[model samples]
Target: MSLQPDQAIEVFYSYAHEDEKVRDKLEKHLTLLRREGVITEWHDRKIGAGKEWQNEIDTHLNSSQIILLLVSANFIASDYCWDVEVKRAMERHETKEARVIPIILDFVDWESAPFGRLQALPEGGRAVKKWGNRDAAFLSVAQGIRIVAKELAVSS
Candidate 1:
């Protein structure tokens, strides 16, 4: 997992619009890693106005070293999330081209989903929405991500 001084991992967030608030909180938790230059992350919300959104998403998704799938009922229901983002993410994951991490954001029937077998964040696969303290859940997820980001380091 060691990397050169110039190397850093790029992270991509694949989430549903319904979960934007949760995603924002999680992104905050990940700030330390970004500050330390361990990783740089992107999501649809980062797309600028007037830009071709799909092209921006595809470029980021294709290049990121770590892909976080923010799983929830809404995420599972989104056609774009399932049919496009998840499809390509999994393809990259299967080929060892990128690492896919399923982040449980809410309770849903997802054990049979494409990312079912991958170990999920906030240990025990407990959904963030179900946690007694939501911040604690995000902290757990961030810590897990830190570990993986370190292990998955790549050339910038």
Candidate 2:
């Protein structure tokens, strides 16, 4: 069931606007995967002009094989991120349709969050902001994503 070399996995990023800086840093770290053509990422920022944002977000959220949640204080407070995106991602994960990876971006008490049952990135669920080197933190997250992508490819 291994995917072909040309196969590409779709990845969706769900984050709060307030954490855009960390999200951008994470996306930058993922550039290697994009360059290698193993994964294509989509976020709200990718929505084209005049496009129905909700529809666009829904389409990507449903179709992406992997969903990354940039968890933080703001992300946890956002109804849309928690109620809509994370909920849907959890559903897909339950059905084995996708893998959900929560990328903790800032110091936040998320142990009680719905996605808390799942494993988080940056290892040990440590917030990226707490890392001595943000770049190193992002690199760790990207490497975890690479492993997940490879596993999904094999399963597919």
Candidate 3:
């Protein structure tokens, strides 16, 4: 299943609420990508209200063409993040309906990540050492998002 140009490439961002700083930076990158016409819409908890969090998440997940997993310690610790987002992304992978891009923001057991076999952005393990600088890390992540956006655009 391919996306339509006018459909707005929906990206479902999965991350732990505890990593608010990382998530905020990612949202900013997504907003920048939108302004550049790289993507039409981006969805994340940062824009949703507490009253309908679950519903809002489901809406984006179902409509998304890709899933960006912000792998972090707290993300792996959250059951909802693991069970719902990870599981759904796995299903999407199985059907080849959506692409799952893991962006390692913090130390996570890559060997045990939901889909560690899939190639990840910013690399993993020792490569994370370079991400110690916040600005550099965000820039690397933004580059990864651009790659995904290009792939989606071409595939569509």
Candidate 4:
């Protein structure tokens, strides 16, 4: 489905709860993108009271132009993250309604990832080592976001 002319570009950040640090970094980056008029992001961290989290997540997953999966060992380990976000995103992808961009925050066996066959960002040598030089990794992630935003713009 095409986004309305005035509808904001919705993005869902999927990651394991254990990887809070990486999630925080992604949130900061997405915030910057929002400030720059790139896209708006949704995540459990931004959920407020009085809202059904599951329904909210499904709504965003259905409406979002892209779902950025923060792939890591911890992310794949979380059943909720996989079943709720990753699987939902995959369904959307099957319908060609939304795109899933897997961002590698930590080394995960790509061949063994829950969502097999999805291409991940910064693969192989470009993969980021834990707590090492994060700048390059963040830059790579930002680039991937830009690419998705550009695609969305063109498609819309």
The lDDT values for all models are: 0.89, 0.90, 0.73, 0.74
What tens digits encode model 1's per-residue C-alpha lDDT throughout 1-156? 334335768899999999898889899999888888888889998899999998999999999989999999999999999999999999999998899999999889999998899999888899998999999998899899889888776322
Worst 10 residues of 4 by lDDT: 122-131
Clashing pairs in 3: none
TM-score to native of every candidate shown: 0.93, 0.95, 0.82, 0.85
lDDT of 1: 0.89
Q: Which ten residues in a row have the lowest lDDT in candidate 1?
A: 1-10
Measured by TM-score, how close is model 4 to the native structure?
A: 0.85
Deviating ranges (above 4 Å) for candidate 4 = 1-7, 123-125, 130-132
Q: Could you give candidate 4's per-residue lDDT for residues 1-156 as a string of tens digits?
A: 233435557788887888878778767766666776668778777778898988887777788988888777888888898777887898888888888878777766755655567776654424566536687677677777777786777777
Residue lDDT tens for model 2, 1-156: 234445878999999999888788888999888888778889999999999999999999999999999998899999999999999999999999999999988889887887888899998889898999988899899999999998988787
lDDT of 2 at 149: 93
- Kindly indicate the candidate among 1 and 2 with the higher lDDT: 2
Best by lDDT: 2
Candidate with best TM-score: 2
Model 3 misplaced regions, further than 4 Å? 1-7, 40-51, 123-130
* Candidate 4 residue pairs in backbone clash: none
lDDT of 3 by residue, 56-133 (tens): 787778778878887888888889989998999889888988888887777667656667888777643323335667
Segments of candidate 1 deviating more than 4 angstroms: 1-6, 154-156
